[model samples]
Target: MVISGPRGTKDMLPESSCRWHYVEQMVRDLCRLYAYQEIRTPIFEHTELFLRGIGETTDVVSKEMYTFTDKGKRSITLRPENTASVVRSFLENKLYAEPQPVKLYYMGPMFRYDRPQAGRLRQFHQFGIEAIGAAGPTIDAEIILLATDFFQKLGLNELTLLINSVGCPQCRPIYRDKLQAFLHDKLDGLCEDCQSRFERNPMRILDCKNENCQTLSHGAPHMTECLCDECQGQFLGLQTLLQAAGITFTLDPRLVRGLDYYTKTAFEIQYPPLGAQSAICGGGRYDGLVEECGGQPTPGIGFAIGLERVLLALEKQQLLPDFKTGIDVYIAPIGDKGKTLAFQLLHQLRRSGLSCDMDMMNRSIKAQLKRANKYPARYVIIIGDEEVDQEKVMVKNMDSGEQCMLALQDVQSMIAGEMDN
Candidate 1:
């Protein structure tokens, strides 16, 4: 039987890879502009990291993680998300001692054992950024602005920015109690997962996707109503700063993100065209994550954008850039002497930074031209015994059908010049 890629994983063909490259370049350029240095971590880590950092009650740790015991009798897991690993890196490397706020970004594949869908995959890529040790509301506004700037630059204008504050540890306990009291009577109506979360983490019920759960929790207490003085001040300050930066956002009281570590600020950027799973980017402040990961107390905030989902949105909206898929020149030789000259010229053109290819099969001039056309080379260089003897070649502009005879050495310069035009 022929082998195939795992389910929920995709093989990116050349055409699809071009789009990936374009998006990746844009992300790198944006990260550079924002002064977020790139950080790469291992694909897997100790299983306890996610449980402690992401919380045992979270879906990622409780249900979705790809975890197993290795030969060393140690439990290891492929990261379903990167924030936990990033926090571990920040602590293990002592990045805290070097700077007050460490700004970092990462791009790579993340794994999870999930049921496949349009935008969600078991193995997917994410472009994410984290600003650690930053405690002010200004940084929160900056992070939100960064997300908006990326979508706008990509010509994705139909995005809605939803912001909320899921009160910090100081006030969250009181809100959790109020929320539990409100939800106690509706326990039977909630989903089984949410019913269990009632006593453990009632706040997560607000983030449930089940229609029945959403409907039952609608009238339950909102975190905003129970926010303490400090959280309220931070939320108001974030709104003011966001307005001053001309970033529009809607206050969503039910937007308690599906992460345990998120505190104070939680925001998600949504593209409405993608039904059901509309969030393309989501993140917020986790002031206590560093401490949870065994590092000193550090205030941090970050966001992750699913690259596959972003690509899907871009393609759906017809916003992807037109990418060239052909080589610069195809060298077609008609005779033995022409073949030798063409082979030498092929390498020369390539060394000069031109994308050039030559026919390996000994085919007739007619067949060679056909292959050249199929290659869709911008220019075709035809070599024959006569041209080889004269040390000149016939270069045809494939698109315009304009043929010109030039010195073998001049072919490279001519193609470069034409490309500029």
Candidate 2:
């Protein structure tokens, strides 16, 4: 039997790993600048956290969750997303008691049993930030600014920020009923998913990706048109705040998020160049999630960026930087005794905060040179029996093809000085 990784998963090989590191580091640095601390939640959590916080009606909770029964017959699930678990942690850990608002960011893998496509995967990674206990629209603007800055840092210029209001409990029901009546008449031409959602979550019908569903639901009632006075005020405040911050955005009345917990001020940042996978980041104000997750009546706003999709978008625009984890120096051993000295040199080079590698498979001198050239080593050292006896080594510049004899004690300073130059 042939064994392989499960489908809808990727290995993230060497070339891509460099890009991953660049993106992750940029996110971390920017989060720090924005005064957002890092928070890590478990990879798996009780199945109910998502079921309650993400809403049982949404696709994530209804179908995509990867759930299983443990030995104790308790239902456990690989986290589909981090928001629910983070909220659970905030409540269980009593983070609410300490601060007025908690600004936190996280980057990690999330598992879902969805169809594999250009950007969609069964197991994917996300970089997200959640601002909790903040009801002001300024927090919403700040979150959007963080996302825009991240994309700008990656050189993704051709992107759009779409904003909307899904309305709160006071008005969502009115829109739901109005939408249900409007969709009911058109149910004969609608897809099965839309038909099911028509009653449970009529707002989601506008968000459906199915071409047929989209076409049939064109005349459906918009959420923005039905928002209550308070939700409308909040939406207007969000737009004003965004404008004040010089963040350009479009009012997309059709942008209802696919989560039940979201209320008022929903948005998605899309890479218009990438067709179906254009949406690299999406989220909204889940003002009710905290209360739903057994916390205080604290409102929250956040967004999540799909790491795989972000990379794909970067590739489409040719904006991805080259990733090279090249070596700083390569050491070649001429013979067995010299090999012992080479090992010692390798250890010392590593301790000196320089990346160094040596031929470990006993390859021929020519083979070792070939391997050294493949890496981005600045200098190559040849340690033979004669050099060991003289307490010196022959250093060759990999790029200039220049050679110089230097004492063993000068190796560290030599490399450091070259680095400075």
Candidate 3:
């Protein structure tokens, strides 16, 4: 019997890994340009952290989280999302004590027991940024701009940027009442999830993806209509700043974040061509998350991008880069003496910044050359008994079918120069 890999987890083979590397490189470069430092937290944390920070009613905590008891009899969970963990890190490290707004970014695998699909997986990766300790609408604008700029940089310009204000604690009650009143009669029509949410968090019903639920939730009161003075101003200010920055967006009254902590300025960017699961990135400001997590009240905003979905979008748009695969040079040796010298030259070439591969099996020179072409080596260095005796090797350019004799010591310099061309 052949044992198979785990479910909902796909191996990142080399070809896919190359593309992932390119995407990650761009992430690091952009983070540097934005002056946002990188932070990495444990892949798992105390289950209570997310339970308190993400809210008990949220799907992440209630349904999807991978929770279990450790040997110590403490409940631990694999992080389904990162914002709550990032906040916990911020508080534990006393980052707020040093800075007013702490800007940080992270990239790593997150676990969620979700049904595997084209771009959705139980074990998926996310690239996120959390700008903590800032309350100004400008910070909100910056977060949005940064996300859009990253997509644009990756040649993903055909995106729908949707923005909304979920309102704050002061005014949310007003909207919640109106929404509940509107949904009171439609409770039986909504999905079971939306029905349960009506009492605990009616606002979340607006975010339901079920068509029937969406229909029931439509025409329900919008948070924007009942925003408090401060929330209203910040929302309007964010719009103005976004316009000044030349980023156009649609106002979605129903755009509530999936997370319970999101207070204001909820937004999601979608690649319409991706069909229903079009959201490649989404996030918003969570002003009360710090206080909810036992830290002093602090305002924060951030976003997380689903990397697999981003890759899917890139594939759909034909924007993925063509990554070349092959070694720089392959060294094939002949006889015992030639093999000894070939091994020495292989290390020498590699030390000089050349990707060189040599024959490990004591195969015939003809067989070695065949395998060399499989690596599709750009250049092949053949060292025979004659050449080894003369302290020289025969070099062949695989592309141009050119051959020449070069001193063994000059192999590194020649290959390095040829690569530069």
Per-residue lDDT of candidate 1, residues 312-369 (tens digit):
9999999998897678899999988998899999999999999999999998878878
Q: After superposition, how far is residue 228 of candidate 2 from its true place, in Å?
A: 1.4
Residue-pair clash count for candidate 1: 0
lDDT values of the candidates?
A: 0.91, 0.89, 0.91
Predicted candidate 3: what Cα RMSD to the true structure?
A: 1.9
Q: Distance (Å) between predicted and true CA of 140, model 1?
A: 0.8
The sequence of per-residue lDDT tens digits that candidate 2 reaches over residues 181-225 is: 887778888888877777776777887888988888887778888
The digit string of per-residue lDDT tens for model 3 on 1-421 reads: 9988777888999999998999999999999988899999999999999999999877888899999999999999999999999999999999988766899999999999877788888899999999999998999999899899999999997899999999998999888888888998999999998788889888778889899998877777788989999999999999999999999999988877878899888999998888777899999999999999999899999999999999999988899988978888899998888989898888988887788899999889899889888888999999998998899999999999898999877877887787788
Residue 299 CA displacement from its true place in model 3, Å: 0.3
TM per candidate: 0.94, 0.94, 0.95
**Model 2 CA deviation exceeding 4 Å by range:** 207-220
Global Cα lDDT for candidate 3: 0.91
